[model samples]
Target: MSFPRSATRSALALAGAGVLVLAWGGSAVAAQQGSTTVEPAGAAFSATLDGEATFETGPITVTCAVSASDPGDGNNLVPDEPDNHNPEGAVGGPINAPNFDDCEADVPLVDVEVEVADAVWDMSMQDGESAVGTMHVPAAGIVVTTSGVASCTATVSPDADVDIEGTWTNGDPVSSLAFDTTAPIEVEGGVGCPDDTEAGFTAAYEVENADDADTPITVGP
Candidate 1:
């Protein structure tokens, strides 16, 4: 489905050469749990969500969501058990038809686990190394990038929720930060480069600042 104009704003409220922002209120960005102090241009800024900034000819939209559900009826696959001790095995059949409990024993519930690794920040600038922001989800998960040139990072451990460990400098820095999804978490949405607006562009995506039903990203010019 196409993104609504409001949703578009939520995803593009911040854009720049190498922007860095902290998680706002309770949204879903990785760095929302903590906060990032803004710095001067070319200054050091660290939050979450990293890798080199990629440029695009036009505006690009990325849709992301996390979901899980109880096994529910979908968990049922095997048939009802029968009285093997009795010689008469013709009283009832399978749940749907002439089948039997043999099928029920094979049913298994498949759990759902989702992880969003990297988000792309489109702007103009070519660089091999620079500043970096890394955000971690409060759960054990993996990071996956839809568009960009970077590694798919973040693997939440089984006992830890997600959280950004720290930001880094790109010019040959330590490994990227990873999110933990299997434990208690305190943060949600955040921005790595809120002040770093793209050249000639004032509008960019942002996390939901408040609990109102308004758009998440606020566009400017």
Candidate 2:
């Protein structure tokens, strides 16, 4: 199955958001509950990224919703349960899933939102070391907004990481940012597409500004 540019944008958006959540998880400060805004200290640059993504085997497709929020307690970054939330949280919503061969007929995936209540982001950019961070989605849940047997809420532990290599400039950002995963991101909860499936993806984007550039990132199967 081929994922269009829009689907890739959604995938990258989720990955980008995952980056922030994991970065703050490493050293999140105390904040109010459900606070969805965080700017990491010593951040060389940041941007609202868009890209497409697909499940490696089933080709399950989705689009991402753009949003932002702050980090929460790093300790509770990886929750033991699903749909868990911290005082400050991250939420992706209103995603639509079209019918796939493996999916039930006319059972479109709708209102798909992944909520992370507790998460942590650990990042480093030392020489010979790729900038990387891991996020634990404690109480993470994916809600199928559509109505059908496939529309049930499924628990997902979206443990994701981001690795990039480029020269960092305060005002001048790198020309582009490349993203990849070392292994397949596994999704639990008996959901089709990603659940019980290995999802691997690679994305590349042209950086307009190091400080903050709204660039379009593209992902390929």
Candidate 3:
């Protein structure tokens, strides 16, 4: 679904608004109820994400291929702890490339990767329903780098949520993850854009299994 350019910009600006809350305030801790085998050490579990995503600057209409990897312990569905200030909620390693373009163009705007530090999601589950929660990256946490047409770098502070209703299963069998939020975020600094510009960006991620292997860990029923 395409969003109007005006709305897209508004959402993006709001996406990073909560960097302070995430950094100082604490998040709800997830209760643990089950046990699952952890992934092997040094093993990187990843998923292939292909979906329609819109950014504040422009429309990402291309069917881009995105990948997220977790180098830490295997996925922890019911994280022993789900607080942003703690380690429990910090599960998924980091999403390497959240947005990219394979199509050709004069400017060839592509290769937009947002590096999330110690990325993690707080998930809640229900029967026959996809899990939902917040995806947090700490203070001064996100760095967005773009290549091709115009090269630029943006350092962002973001606090976003997993858009529950949009979560669903893809060809990967297991359900995919989707997140969105429009909080007041901060753009610490950036290149290419005007100085002192508090550029806002609404971010969404649709992650699916990139391989046949079992999901690093399981969540939900």
Candidate 4:
């Protein structure tokens, strides 16, 4: 999300990220139950659904009441390397797919189920313009199940990349992660799937330290 990818999860909000920011694969992103973060130098962090997290595909919109990163430990700063994603340093995320609850669809009587890939999603913080950097959903696809009016299963296949944007106020974790931009999501499902193959995702997550609930996650230089 808006935060460092290699850092934490708002979802911990994929742009539905809680960019939970679930990841593709490489390192894990940390969440609560003791999720951690090292900071600007580089570290893992955890986040939660600040307000709400949503996923839209075709005409169907999925709304989740709760979202969070898989709880774990990590987000410590890595030493500088010649060609690392995090110039200041890099920290492998300690996490998995964001968890969801109270989820429903814009369409009537439709139940939505999301199964994040099992394992630590990839979280790589990109080199930023300043102390601030950008965090995209680590990587991995979300398996979504729809039943009732809509009977079918869909997956945010292969690569789902979304950014978690922030206001840049001294780089502090906020109550929400604003995906300043939209990310494209790919889907593969049965005949019950939406007519269109393309889908869009947007969301905001409230980020914080998983381990230290009181301590706000911050990125510094």
What TM-score would each prediction reach against the true structure? 0.17, 0.38, 0.41, 0.59
Model 3's alpha-carbon lDDT is: 0.32
lDDT of 2 by residue, 58-115 (tens): 3323322332222222211212223222233441111111111111211132323333
User: Largest TM-score belongs to which candidate?
Assistant: 4
Best model per lDDT: 4
C-alpha positional error of residue 158 in candidate 3 after TM-score superposition, expressed in Å: 6.5
Candidate that beats the other on TM-score, 2 or 3, i.e. the better one: 3
Error (Å) of candidate 2 at residue 172 is 3.7
State each model's CA lDDT, in order: 0.20, 0.25, 0.32, 0.41
Tens-digit lDDT track for model 3 on 93-181? 33332223332211232445544544443233222333333344344344544444334445544444322222323323344545332
User: Global lDDT for candidate 1?
Assistant: 0.20
Backbone clash count, each prediction separately: 56, 31, 13, 38
Order the candidates by lDDT, highest first: 4, 3, 2, 1
lDDT of 4 by residue, 108-200 (tens): 434445565554344433323422223435444455554444345444434544443333222344433443333444444454444334454
Using TM-score as the yardstick, the better of models 3 and 4 is 4
Model 1: CA > 4 A from native? 1-66, 72-139, 145-149, 157-221
Q: Report the candidate with higher lDDT, 2 versus 3.
A: 3
Sort by TM-score, best first. Answer: 4, 3, 2, 1
